[model samples]
Target: MTDDTNCIEVVTLTPLAQRFSYRCRTPLPEPGCRVHVPFGRGERIAIVTGSSPCPEGVQIKDVRTVLDQQPLLPKALQALLEFGSNYYHYPLGGAWATALPARLCQGEPLPTPKPELWKLRSDATLPQSGWGLRQSELLQRLRRGNLRMTELGSGDRQRIRQFLAAGWIEAARESPRLHETPLTLRPEQQQAVAAIRAACGFQPFLLDGVTSSGKTEVYLQSMEPLLLAGKQVLLLVPEIALIGQTYERCVQRFGATAVAVYHSGQGDAERLRVWERARSGSLSILLGTRSALFVPLARPGLLIVDEEHDPSYKQQSGWLYSARDLGLRRAQLEELPIVLASATPALESLYNRQCGRYADLRLRERASAQNIPQIEILPLRKKRLLGGLDPSLLSACAETLASGQQALFFLNRRGYAPALLCHDCGHVPHCRRCSAPLTWHRRQARLRCHHCGWEAPVPQRCPSCGGDGMNGIGMGTEGLEQFLQERFPNIPILRVDRDEVHTPRQLAERLQAIRSTRPAILLGTQMLSKGHHFPDVTLVGIVDVDQGLYSADFRAGERLAQTVIQVAGRSGRGDAPGRVLLQSHLPEHPLLLALQSGDYGTAAAQLLRERQQAGLPPLRALALLQAEAQRVEPVYAFLHAAQEYFQGSLDCSGPVPALLERRAGFHRAYLWLESTSRPLLQQVLGASMPQIPSLPGARRVRWSLDVDPQNF
Candidate 1:
């Protein structure tokens, strides 16, 4: 280390690359200090990771100015970030942008918390007369003990207002106490908790409990020992919607001040505050989505990933990192124990368990002793359907509603209609730039492409033949909503889909309304499925299950099985028994039969055998290099050159048309790269990516490499 002043030169953190570098400036603070620097004619905020001698004879820019008076990120988080950048093949600076909150990245100052308190006056005493019934109850409770300011109810507020005006009660300064009572756990839950508590140090435990088997209770119990040891805990959920529910439960055990939420939904200021709180050791528990894995804890001891198999845990955009994978890695690095809680574990996780990479802990029986929902298959080929609902499903919904219970209709598609067909000429409206049909959006009076987000007016005549006789074809969530509205004119019907509910607040409000009013029917897409608990939902109808079974993607069957199970799990959560009616053209399909019998183990075994024989994921590592250009030949030429570059180490296939070959005026083509070992594939990609980008026709097209792609 040099002198404090001349020790560091210019320190800069670039958002474009997420790299932290230092140049000789006058004198600078220590590494980890935040500074402002001149970057491309604009000043941006950056952190100093280190100070080193400027490279001789190389042009160097001096540090502009220092931003934070103190260091923002500690050494541990810096190491983790460096690991993530190299592992994900993403820019270091870009990873930091993802790790830090938006406000901090934009150079906002940290906030000072304004703490408030409530106290009873010295002369305050139990009311002897002239108190309203509600006020009297509140006064009696307060007489028994001291009450915090924020904890006062409306009745207490009214009485307090009177007392304050009369100078009979006074407010005092005290620390905030925002704690609630924990729920009573069942015996099985207690046993699961005890077993998890007995484990120590860097252990991997899988909590394979049935839906509502009190898996969360096991998590809470396992977390207690870690927290008691003064260690921080990180809880990862699949979506932001889950954060609220899980956060509430955590607050009930550990006070509100101990837990903080991190997600994209929060405003910049709130996110920055939470970030500071987590970093400063003001918060002990952190709950969030996949990105939460990057949170910098003061002392991380335990990492819990709830619903470990959910695909949402794997971020498809940007860095393309899997949160579940990172959780395991982070736990190992920190020498901490991790709990992966899931009803149906992913194949990769199951493989890990089989290979002794993780310890298995099964909560085989339901904690509450509730029976699983009855699953009935309705063969669509033999039954006449009305607006996607079969007679049996409709009858079930009617019976459920009549008994004062709720019903849910699951249709994965969301637009009003899937396609518009011309009756006169047998023509269909297709997206002008993509090889796919344009969906009709009745509310918007336009045909929209879900993939490229292209929209156009609903033409009165077919473009091919100028025919006026056209009709909307196939059922979607919107169409189903219309059908249910007309059929049940007197009952309230709530449609929960991407189009209807766009925000977490909207989804929460709709769910709350459904819970309060148990007689309504919920008609929507798979958005209504996954993780929501509706105790009064006695009936669930799967509108069309055949689409998943016939999709070109190899993982379609697995996805369909997971989705069917998740949707069925939503029913019969309470004491009232529930039923599920699945409508499919292939009712006798092996996957469907396995699902109906509640035999996920058998289904997974069969799928694993098939995957092994076919050389799919978990057996081989795969990557996809996609290229798109205005003309199709350019993509082919680029791919051909790429194929020539990787001569022997890797297997190259497919310069074929992508699933949707044309999109937004571009023709797309993909080349598949596969290897039995991950290291070999990484090496091939590392060597070939730079060369492929500079090939002929490369300048005229856009390309990206997707490692472990979920969709083709």
Candidate 2:
């Protein structure tokens, strides 16, 4: 083999579904390191995957500079990425791009952690006569004890660097200091923690705990041993909003230096720093959202997915992968333990427990001496609501506030109203780019489409009929907040939602404000529902329970139940008695009646039975081959042509319009594939997927395949 034609395999940050071959000189960079390579008359950064022998008579481009001296990702993390790519049927390059931080993908220099402390080397003897006075003094201080580099003068720091090069001094590793003691665990919590701590390898446990049942405490205690033994822990939450409070709690238990938080909301440099520290085994614990699942853990000991059932754990776009499922695979690969903690576990998780794949650890009672919240349904049989609140619910909130406790109103809509209705013409203004109606944002005086992000000014008159009567049709958190403020003018009404709180600092401040204002009214979309602890929030009012009563998706019931239970969980967490009033038009609905029992297990079991009977997920394997384009015909034409390649004993439905047929100026459609056996489905997909892009209609539309998809 010619030395100049040595073949190397690389993957670039592109949507292409395969790796490329490049020829470079000998001594190539190891797999997982970033490399600059020539492509299409330009240079692009790529990741070195492996090497293969050059094909005879086949010309290839040369590799440019190697970005890192060593592999950026650890071996185990690389494996996880590869496994996720294959399982999700996404492109390998795209998978790598998603796994790595944006700066790394752009060929930015790998972050090098600066040492904080310095000490004298073991064998170094003081140069009594040859060294300068400042150097001698610095060495004397170092000999006494490790000194922080930050605490030294500039002259001393420069001298210390010289001593480091001369092998007279070395970097010192500081141990993490414990700032707080562990809280006393309940009996069930102790059992759960013991089970987790005693596990040897490759164990998956479902920490099924109710609201305020101390699941976090169990996680803390379970992680203590591993952290003390010099092992790292990974904790995944479902929301960016939750990271601030969770990080604070972890910092209180473990010192601030020992804990770090990563999410998309942070700056690129900050994320890269945390990634490097975790890869170097210096960070003791990492808490983050879904994207942090790919972060490299040098000493992987335990992985915990808080609120594992959350749909936020599933990536809805780009790479369709579930962090919860991938975390399980990661733990199995690293031979460690993983805990999936949730009050309302997903049906799939419960099924896995039933199938003996995961150990079930349950916490049935509240950790606090407070009683469980009383749940009731308020029937809305043509009852007029004051800005979407049932009178009974309003009275309950008033009573709770009268008792010196807080009340929360849960509304999953953010704007002032769901739509701008032309009352005179009986016509509602819809988004021109999508099939959905534009939401009315009264505060901003704009009509916004939540689906396509299309916005327009509120019409002074009906555009279609030239009518003057245009009004908001339905209630949202913003409108509800306004009405509540008018009703309880003296009381504080805080709105917690995406528009109100944008950063971790803002969220922290808002939460602190909530804590300070007792007997306050909190209202927001689902942003306030996940894992927020308000000890004084004794009442939770689910503003519109009927919104989710009917849906086209099969998992709608499960999602609805989970949302109700999760929102209801936010109340009655303190010493005072708690209550939840789910205002519904259909109070007699089977799902609502089932939820009235306050037993998610029972509701989940019923939903599972329905799913099994309907041949849906947890009992069947499913994937969606979706296509979208500017025109409707191209989407259908592409999907129809793509459907002909499938060879399987499986059900292939669609070439049908999506639930939202139009979104963001694209006409969307999909092909649904389902099978009884997962391996057989994979086999069919593996054979057919390669031929999809080559079809004649493929170029007219953008298409992707989503395995185990959560969204319709």
lDDT of each: 0.76, 0.87
TM-score (C-alpha) between model 2 and the true structure: 0.96
Q: Which stretches of candidate 1 lie over 4 Å from their true place?
A: 1-22, 26-32, 69-71, 112-188, 687-692
Clashes of 1: 9
Query: What TM-score would each prediction reach against the true structure?
Result: 0.87, 0.96
For candidate 2, the 10 contiguous residues with the lowest summed lDDT are 1-10
Off by over 4 Å in 2: 1-5, 127-145, 153-156, 647-649
In model 2, pairs of residues that clash are none
Among these predicted structures, which one has the highest TM-score? 2
| Per-residue lDDT of candidate 2, residues 120-208 (tens digit) | 88898656588777877777798799998778988888888898888888888666656887898878888999999999999999988
Q: Highest lDDT: which candidate? A: 2
What is the clash tally of candidate 2?
A: 0
